[model samples]
Target: MALAIAVGLLLASGTAAADRVPLPALVKAHRGEACVEPLPVIRRDHMKFLMHQRDDTVHEGIRGARHSLVGCIDCHAAKDDAGRWVRIDAPGQFCASCHEYVSVTIDCFGCHAALPTVAFRKTAE
Candidate 1:
């Protein structure tokens, strides 16, 4: 009871910024600053772009690089300690970390490969 009161007093005094929860750590994209859209725009509209791209690919039979899931996996997939590529939707991985934090259901990997089929090495600088 005493500990709880102390915590409450600290919070009520504005000493605790209640909204300052740590966000999930995101992996850097392989291409760094070469995303199709700017960071803010992409963070806000990535779902919309993915859905639109899905519609076009499935119904219209059109596939392009601009918003392709393949492109995303290729660019965002990280490596394991053994040098194998990790699935994008796995826990702590690119997709799962954020989606879990935001309470969003991730259904994309249900019918799609979460890791690229081909290997992609970072280019030498």
Candidate 2:
């Protein structure tokens, strides 16, 4: 009876550990210029920045600000091994990986194009 209880406890602990969320696979950003804000600031308040940028663009007739969504797509979008452009919000890609990690369902790509108009050549490693 003691052996059975020990085995049950061990199994329960293992199951609990396995239920923890694993670290997300973040995409490596490839950008020509530095980001609009520091990494820590951007990580904490990016949604607020994006919302403000959208308001300026739609209501104030402003466009192409540093915080614009198009700027983000241009910097974060990547290419596959085949050299074809990959969507920023694709699985394991830039936007999707982080949003999915936090259990957030985003509709940013529903209206916006995921690919950047400017084509970037992968730098030679």
Candidate 3:
């Protein structure tokens, strides 16, 4: 009976660990840019594209939350100094803007660098 209880406890602990949220890795390198920096650049079409990408289970997963919790809008959905839709600094700021109100500590940004520049690549001649 003691052995069975121990096994059950171990199984429960393993299940709990598996339920823990997983964070994505940071964007350390980008298109040959060693010191990849964050930039705010928002495009309507790009936003829509991401919306589609997440909503599409074939590409991501059911509801896409498993693939990425912060769909494009979660970070890129903001207005600029000119009152135009644009990405924000620390893209984590966008997340914190909401999470702070709820007093939630987010570790997602630890491994994942919150930068608007993470999405695209520039081609130079």
How close is every model to the real structure, measured as TM-score?
0.76, 0.75, 0.30
Measured by TM-score, the strongest candidate is 1
Candidate 1: give its CA RMSD in angstroms: 4.4
Instruction: Return whichever of 1 and 3 wins on lDDT.
Output: 1
Off by over 4 Å in 2: 1-23, 119-125
lDDT of 1 by residue, 1-125 (tens): 99999989988867455556667899777654687888889888999999999999999999864899998987888888887888999898887899899989878789998986466446522
Two-way TM-score contest, 1 vs 3, winner: 1
Instruction: List pairs with backbone clashes in candidate 3.
Output: 26-111
Taken over the whole model, the C-alpha lDDT of each candidate is: 0.82, 0.85, 0.45
Q: In model 1, which runs have C-alpha deviations exceeding 4 angstroms?
A: 1-22, 120-125
C-alpha positional error of residue 36 in candidate 3 after TM-score superposition, expressed in Å? 28
Q: After superposition, how far is residue 87 of candidate 3 from its true place, in Å?
A: 7.5
lDDT of 2 by residue, 7-106 (tens): 9999999999889756587777777566789987988899999999999999998998989999898888888999777999888898889888887888
Clash-forming residue pairs, model 2 = none
**Residue-level lDDT tens digits of model 3 in 1-125:** 99999999999999998896433333222133221123332211433444555567546555644224344333444444674434333444454554444465656456544544333436311
